[model samples]
Target: MLLCWLLFIPFIGGLACWFVSRRNPDSNAARWIALASMALVFLPALSLWFGGDFSLPSHLSASPDWNRELSVPWIQQFGIAFHLGLDGLSLIMVMLASVLGMLAIAASWSSVRSRVGLFHANLLWTLGGVIGIFLAIDLFLYFFFWELMLIPMYFLIALWGHEEYDRGAHMRAAIKFFIYTQTSGLLMLAAILGLVFAYYSETGILTFDYNQLLGAHVSGTFGFVLMLGFFIAFAVKLPSVPFHGWLADTQANSPSSGAADLSGILVKTAAYGLLRFTLPLFPEASAQFAPFAIALGLISIYYGAVMAFAQNDMKRLISYSSISHMGFVMIGLYAGTFLALQGVIVQVVASAISTAALFILAGQLYERMGTRDMRQLGGLFGRLGALPGFALIFVVASLGMPATANFIGEFLILFGAFSVMPWVVVVASGGMILAAVYALYLMHRVYWGTPQGQETIARMRAREYAIMMALVVITLIVGLFPNTVLSVTQGTMNDISHWFAAGVIAASQAS
Candidate 1:
């Protein structure tokens, strides 16, 4: 029941915001309503985190032990159910979404003045869709939420995005994002249907229930093909390497809040999908494909870092840097060790915080400076009170500075994976050096050089200060005491690792 509320509150609040805005376009009612709605969702998730029992059972099983679950028949003719479940993995994701959603609203409070109500409605709806993606247990429901999130995001980018010289650039970026994600999403849909039909042929039952389908005897070429479909979808969403063309443009053009969501929350959904569905559903195929996935991860890491180093646009730089960060997540996902998997969880949460903070900071810088090009702005460290210092902290965090969450995540990933894939870990380590170069280059170009203009920039506002401080605190706490995050996600990560290992063993024996 609470899971349903968590999923529905943002949606209901979005509609309410739209209606409230229609009635009072000039008032702050819509913003407050959206904030309250997120608060409503966040409090429950926080309670679950504190109060829920997430300890790993002494005896592990093929099936996961969900802390909470709800299932109600929906589309009975097609064997679909309105299924929702929460484990530690999902609890953390939802909480992240809630926290980021609220901050995104605060970040946009001043900049988005035209359609205040509609802007927030889209924001809340996009978040609602993301939460739905995290919670949905039925494949059909998952796909539904997956597509649901994209439309509002399109609106977000197209409607409120930053317009440089060309007005249509944002729209083009939005459409490109939609087409890439939607087309890949369709492939996943086809794969889902193919799996369902395959199961139906064997058991005369047509169902999209994740638990039931998990036992579906899928293997051989058919299984691998289905897995590819799902993998491509997630990769595109993950925006890995070749499939990542849409991300830089989209992030560069999107409104700051939209970029934060894109970088922080939306991309994590791909990692989640890989963990929750792709590996678990077609473990053998995933294992077979692990080498290729790791190779792509390597490519994305180096490619993103190189591209970021070459970028003058601050947003594009951050976007490419995110690609590099997610590459670590990709490697962690496929490493198939308990430690590597735990690192994936931490990296996902930590990267989301640090990256989102940077995007928000970039947005703030743009608001005051009237540009995102690093070449156009310099000597900001002394001019912008507190903002530059905050940027420096997050920038260093992005490069996996010691005592930060990024370091813990990357260290665990590399160390854990080295035991399994020493050569791959060794090669990936070069990315750390490249990351430092680009991160520092970003600070130097934007903050340490001669002043491009002598204009007096406004100091950080109260809201901006609060948001940055909160994010900084989160990054440090998670960095210093990752156990807080590790403890909650350990059980889920362990279960996933076990499931994948069993599949690996089965595949090996069969081979």
Candidate 2:
């Protein structure tokens, strides 16, 4: 019931916001309604997290576990159920979604003036769809939410995004985003049908339930083919190396709030899909594919970092940096160990917060200076006042500085990945050095050089300060006691590792 409410409130709130905006076009009611709805969501999500048993002992049982769940029959003919569940894995993701949901709302308060009602409506809808993605345990339901998320995001970029001296710029980016994600989604849908039909062929029982599908017996070439469908779907969403063409454009032109959601949570969904679906559903295939995937991660690390250095656009630089950071997540996931998987979870959370903070900061810079070109900006330290300090914090965090969550996540990923693939991990580690160069170069160009003009922009407002400070505090706390997140996910990662190993053993024996 509570799970339903978490999903329901945002959608209801969006309609209410639309109504409110329609009635009072000049009022700030739409923004407040969106913020209030997001705030309300945090309570239920928090309760779900604390209500669970965090102790590892609880996981000793050999039974499937779910801390909170709601299952009801839906679409009986297709074997789909309105299934939702929360475990340690989903709890953190939901929490991140709610937190960033609010920040994205707050970040839009002043900037989004045109179509205020419509904008807030889209924001809430996008968030509602994301919450669905995090909680839905049924594969069909998961893919439904996956496709739902993109529509509002396209509207967001198309209607409210930036256009630097070009007509239809935002629209083009939005179209590119739509085409890529929608195409990937079609691939995922095909894979879902394949898996369900495969299961029915063997057992004569049709279902789209995640747990039931885990027992699927498809193997050899057929299993490998089904796994490829899932992997490609997730990989496109991950926008890894070769599939990353759409990200830079989308981020570069998107409104700050949209970019925050994109970098912060949208991309993380891809990582989550890999963890939640691709690996567990087809573990043997994942193992067979790990070497090639790790090589791609290494390439992303170097490619993203180097390309970031070449970008003159501030948003593009941050977007490329995002690619590099996610590369570490790729390494940890394919490394195939409990420790490495834990690091992947930590990296997902930390990278989202840190990257979102930078996007928020980037928005702030654009608002003040009227441009995001690094070359045109200079010596903002004296002129912009305290924003430079906050920007510096995010910049250092991006570079994996000590005492920050980014540092902890990267260290663990590298440490765990080293055991399985030392050479690859060593090669990927070079990203840290390149990260430092690009991160500092951004800082040097934006805040430490000569001012571009005498255009005096306002200092950080209370709302902006609150947003950045909250992100900074979160990074610190997670860095200091990563166990806060690790403990919750430890049991889940252990179970997944076991599944991977068992599947590999089964596949080899069959062959």
Which has the greatest lDDT? Answer: 1
State every prediction's TM-score relative to the real structure: 0.98, 0.97
Q: For every candidate structure, what is the RMSD over all alpha carbons to the true structure, in angstroms?
A: 1.1, 1.5
Off by over 4 Å in 1: 452-456
- Residue pair clashes in candidate 1: none
Q: Write down the lDDT that model 1 would get.
A: 0.93
The TM-score of predicted model 2 comes to: 0.97
Tens digits of lDDT, candidate 1, 1-511 = 8998999999999999999999989999999999999999999999999998888778776667789999999999999999999999999999999999999999988888989999999999999999999999999999999999999999999998888756889999999999999999999999999999999998999999998998899999999999999999999999799899999999999999999999999999999999999988998988888999999999999999999999989999999999999999899989888899889988998889998999999999988879998878788877888999999999999999988999999999998899889999999999999999999999999999877667657999999999999999999998999998899988888888887888788778878
Top-TM-score candidate index: 1
Model 2 residue 142 lDDT?
96
Residue 464 C-alpha lDDT in model 2: 88
